[model samples]
Target: LYAGVGSLSNIGDQGMEAEEGRAAIWRLDLETEQAGIFASGLRNAVGMAWEPSTGTLWTVVNERDGLGDETPPDYLTSVREGGFYGWPYCYWGQTVDDRVPQDPALVARAITPDYALGGHTASLGLCWMPAGTLPGFPDGMVIGQHGSWNRSTLSGYRVIFVPFAGGKPSGPPRDILSGFLSDDEKTAYGRPVGVAIGADGKSLLVADDVGDIIWRVTAA
Candidate 1:
């Protein structure tokens, strides 16, 4: 099984003391009774799924907050074993974050993610659709962005669809459902957390945490 761990105190801002054993994906082998980190430097990889066509493990990560509204974008990408994704020291492959002290060697080693899900979107849900379901969507991913709080203007608060080609994201994101935030933006009618394809195989099931609702969207 693969489990993702989040860092404490926003990428070691309070100091690396709180970062021990954090910001990584751990793998456990039941047969051997062994456990180890599968990957590192991911701040908050909240959602994960396996792409059926490629059998690749993909993850949707919520990047660090407080970095303004658009500095760093949350991402969806194939998780490489033993890969290092930028968390505190850098973002989006070699973009140096001067807020914290960084090791140049580690920054150079950081790998860029495949697709950007917009900065401060708080993206947390991921689901892959197989062929014959959502014909317009083809074989792709549907993500739920639960919205943002730190930004001056809100972001996310909706579901997005990413088309897949050759086992990777191939086009711009399309909206699935939205309008979770109130008009004034002071209240949230709903917050999407998790998403999955329905058992019927042609509809999408969305888990809304705040409103206590599960939305069902079928292909038209």
Candidate 2:
């Protein structure tokens, strides 16, 4: 299960409602209406998947607030239960923004995310390629950073791959699908929101919300 803060609020901002912005990972026991918190403090995790090899759950998180067009960078993270990724308090480990009040006590209590995906990427869908499938893909997670609209220059709107080693994320992301925008790099044709490995074992599926189309990518 993946959990993250669903809203924008600093660690101890009294004005912020927990229910409004907080996200939590929960497992539902269908036998009972019982669910438990697996993790917390995620701004918005729109995509999640479990790796078949290590049984680890990974998520792509949309960080809180635009932060005046350049403050906080949206992220793709490997979520761990009982982990508190600093949402409104701190971002990308230690850069503190004053717009959101920081509680030194709570800030010290938060766990930093696994990877920093740069600012305003609007990361959305996440998927992991199973082993022995695509020759070059290996077994890593691919995330669709949905690009940015709340920025002056704009960012994201492309598909990227995050390689994994030893059953964990090893490094930063590499662009896999680009050129969605025109030559000016201003207008966009498709806004990728989801990514999944095709059932054929050799194709990649991507959903573009703006274009209202689903694209299939195959090994060349």
Poorest stretch of ten by lDDT in candidate 1: 130-139
The clash numbers for all candidates, in the given order, read 0, 14
> Model 2 over residues 132-212: C-alpha lDDT tens digits?
555666668888877887777778889988888887787767777887877676789988988988988887899999889
What are the TM-scores, per candidate, against the unseen true structure? 0.95, 0.86
Candidate 1: count of backbone clashes, pairs at least 3 residues apart or interchain: 0
**C-alpha lDDT of candidate 1 relative to the true structure:** 0.88
What is the lDDT, from 0 to 100, of the residue 216 in candidate 2? 86
Question: Alpha carbon lDDT of residue 213, candidate 1?
Answer: 93
How far in Å is the alpha carbon of 108 misplaced in model 1?
1.0
| Top TM-score prediction, candidate number | 1
